[model samples]
Target: MKNILIVGGSKGIGNAILLQQLEQNKVYNISRNAPEVTHDNLVHFSLNVLEDALPEIESIDTIIYCPGSINLKPINSLSIDDFRNDFEINVIGAVKVIQKYLATLKKGTNPSIVLFSTVAAKLGMPFHASIATAKAGVEGLVKSLGAELASAVRINAIAPTITDTTLAAGILRNDRMKENMVERHPMKGYLQATEVAGMADFLISDKAKSISGQVFEMDYGIVSFKI
Candidate 1:
């Protein structure tokens, strides 16, 4: 069994991943809030990735940074603080966690790091400037750090389109809104939180050992097709 450290594992994709892996892996859930469910193999730690320091972990086989922000606004309407906040949560927070646990991760068995990105980073979407900018930086981190730690660890990211989660409740509230979202993607379905979490699970598993520095676009064809 491996030891996994997931920042922002309290809810949404992170929470789903925590639940899926806790049965076999020793998982640490660090976030401002604790997970809704608890297990023997699951440990909870309160943390604010943008503000607080992480607790020392013994050995981390996989590192998943899940803290993200969605401040969708036109470029002209968005203030500098909005960009700063997004960067702090989506980029700097992940950097802090990775830097803090780099030593422990290097000591693990085929260690890997998983980060979350957004399809908007690749596909141009109106009112997505803040999140897209932040996630773009995350993609860069995966590429640069993946190379820097190639011998010691693997790092990758998942860029999913609008997913069904509390964080996205505002966007998927009514059938009209949901339909509009589904219509945007060639695949006429919403991206589930579990599906994204499953990919994260795979990256950390031995099956994906050969993969690194890659950004998996789980965007349901948003970046590929116009239909």
Candidate 2:
């Protein structure tokens, strides 16, 4: 069975991907807090991606970095630590995972690495300067690593906008905010957590062998046809 490690898989999109893949692979979810999933193939560990490099790594088949923080603020109001923290979690976190699992990945038949970014990293949006800027760094990190890890491991990222995760509580909590977000997309709805899991599965599967060093926007057409 393929062995996969997911950093920050206790909640949001990460948990969905971990659960979806459990049917076929041995899944290890690294999180500081306990997750609410149980299965023979699923192993949950208390891990801090920011303070740790990855744990219990074996011949890793695929690894996904899911630690991200959203700090939305205007340029003038943004603090130095805000930018630093964003990079620490979103950019540095991915690097730590790759470095820790690089050797193990090389031992796999065809290893894959996935990171999460934001649609704001590609498309422009207001009040997204801080998180957007950090996720933009994430976009660059994946591409560069993809090239360096080729043949053995493939690196890719998923950038989504306005998904229905707890991370989007502020935006989806109120009627005005919800309606405003829906109106921006032609589909008039947000991308679901499962939709992203499907994308992640594709990226790590044989069908995506030719895909790497790119950010896939599963944004409900947020980048296309700005109506």
lDDT per residue (tens digit) for residues 124-189 in model 1: 889999999999999999999989999999999999888899999999999999999988778888
Task: Give per-candidate clash totals.
Answer: 0, 0
The sequence of per-residue lDDT tens digits that candidate 2 reaches over residues 1-227 is: 88988888888899889889989999988899867878999888886877865675666889988888767778889998988999898998888777877888888867899999998988888878889989999999888887887666789999988788888787789889888988888878888888898999999899999998989888778787666
Q: What is the lDDT of every predicted structure here?
A: 0.91, 0.85
Clashes of 1: 0
Score residue 143 of candidate 2 by CA lDDT.
Answer: 82
TM-scores, in order shown?
0.98, 0.95
Q: Itemize residue pairs with steric clashes in candidate 2.
A: none
Query: Whose TM-score is greatest here?
Result: 1
